[model samples]
Target: MRTKAKRAGIACAISILIAGAAIGAPRDVPTGDGMYANIKTTRGEITVRLEFQKTPMTVCNFVGLAEGTLAAAGGKPFYDGLAFHRVIADFMIQGGDPAGNGSGGPGYKFPDEFDPGLRHDGPGVLSMANAGPGTNGSQFFITHKATPWLDDKHTVFGRVVQGQEVVDAVKQGDKIEKITIVREGAAAKAFKADQASFDAYLKDSGGAAAAKAKARKDADLATIAAKYPQALKTASGMRYLILKKGTGAKPVAGKTVSVNYKGMFLSGETFDASDLHGGPIDFQAGAGRIIPGWEEAVLDMQVGEKRLVVLPPELAYGERGAGGVIPPNAFLVFEMELVKIK
Candidate 1:
């Protein structure tokens, strides 16, 4: 398995071959032409360094919309204070839904701008969201982890330049006050220049590097999972139930979903669950909005559905467990019920 460094090196090497524009300042406000600036939110502000030189249409699509007024922007940059829409504590934070609700997009599709040069491995590395091939439109994601799978499948045209904490601070219901796009000259450069200090913080946290070994392991499992029941191993000594199986209208990638679940440790101790007054942990599937395991399991179920998922050590919390109750490396049993599939 490639180490995180190896993966990034490989990504950088590939970027050169494909001619995807690279960021000189890896951790700044993105110092590229025609990018976004003064991206204000109730939480704070940040900026984006886009790769218009490589992805003209994609950048134009975003910049064109963000630069114009709600009506002038030809629509809304992001309608009415939208939430991150999809968040996975340490993986990524995705939002910018103009519909005010999660189920909205730019309402079109374009061929992928697959630049082997760029990667989604570092913090703030932005990538486009898609339903499938040639389907990218308005939805985008900001990585909190090094997502190697998105190397060439999606168009990763930019990265955040500042206020990544502001990005991480955004909660489930947090709204995107608005997004503004400024050219790469003064305004954008100013934001991109702030990354040296921010990059210092990033270095303390291990720089743009991420837990890639985990991503690779998960990727292997993801392949196994993509095959699904066929690859589902009953194992030698396990007693588990198929709480449910989902194969309904796939939850669109940018929409929110409501689900309730009861999780128990191998020794019969309950650790984490979604049956709370806080309501369902609503988020979009496949957008790193939740754990990778959760993303894989929920894609098939329809509305008003449920499933019993018995996850092995790798799929569950793994060696880190939830502490106190669940032991490290313990398998888990979950009785998951999907309440609303919006």
Candidate 2:
């Protein structure tokens, strides 16, 4: 359990909340052409118009939780007493954990719904928070400033339709007294019905049970090692096997390198890949821009070299794993190909 620093682009930005007294009464907002969620906090009310047309899955999931239609173990409202667990004044304000802690969720997870149309243009943008890709849960955040870095990384389900002042004034530990869904728009009702059906089906088929079981899977390092018997092991527990030897010089500190890589869990579940979006990502070789394992491993590789690297959690995300995708003490596998060094 080493002390882990927060990653710059990681979405596990929400922190656990410390319980506090309420600041205001719960209230509702008048709905308009679309689905609206009036989030009543201790300070004031902030109304957001959900974008079901663009991100239907995300909007429906949120509405169901708010209406108490999506119950957990005992069937209770999810956001009634939860506080804005984490709040970074210029970044975003996060909440929606019933336990007031960032660790709590709706007892299940769902896939991410990404839409290029929606973006973090300015303040009042509402988006789902996750540990990584396809791990959307109940936690959400409202931005106070434009965050282009978070555009496609998180699901933008809704935007502040009214009450920017309240959103700006909110702080951590301020209670979310209630979240009321006003489906005045036709789109809202449609999404609400769809989500209800989805939740009911999940309850009937025990989808959450299956998903939880999958998440608790054992590490796949043994399987990978047996598959790649020729891999070399390092003193730091990092393992690697060269795929393609380079023709140019090896990269050093302060030199930038561009590479294509695919990162996966020991379970063979791919967590990220540069190919998924488009091209390779460039970063300084030993500038601490990536995980310690990557910085150290890539330093020895030359341009055009490709290697399969295996890393222990200690050298990766460690105790505080990246949100939900990388669990505690998890092992990882990466196929990295260096394209250029400058």
Question: lDDT scores for all predictions?
Answer: 0.61, 0.78
Q: What TM-score would each prediction reach against the true structure?
A: 0.43, 0.54
Q: Which residue runs does candidate 2 get wrong by more than 4 Å?
A: 1-31, 193-196, 199-342
RMSD (Cα, Å) of candidate 2?
16.7
Error of 2 at 279 (Å): 25
Candidate 2 lDDT over residue span 243-289, tens digit each: 99988888889999998999997667799999997989999878887
On a 0 to 100 scale, what is the lDDT of residue 134 in model 1? 59
lDDT by residue for model 1 over 1-342, one digit each (tens)? 569889999999988854422211123445555555455655666576777656655665555556443232364453335667787888887776666455677665555665667888788887887665556656777887788866766789887777676667766666666666656665434432122332343343332124533564466455435534443454432233444555556576767787788786434567767755465777777788565556666665676667666576666666544534554455666666767777
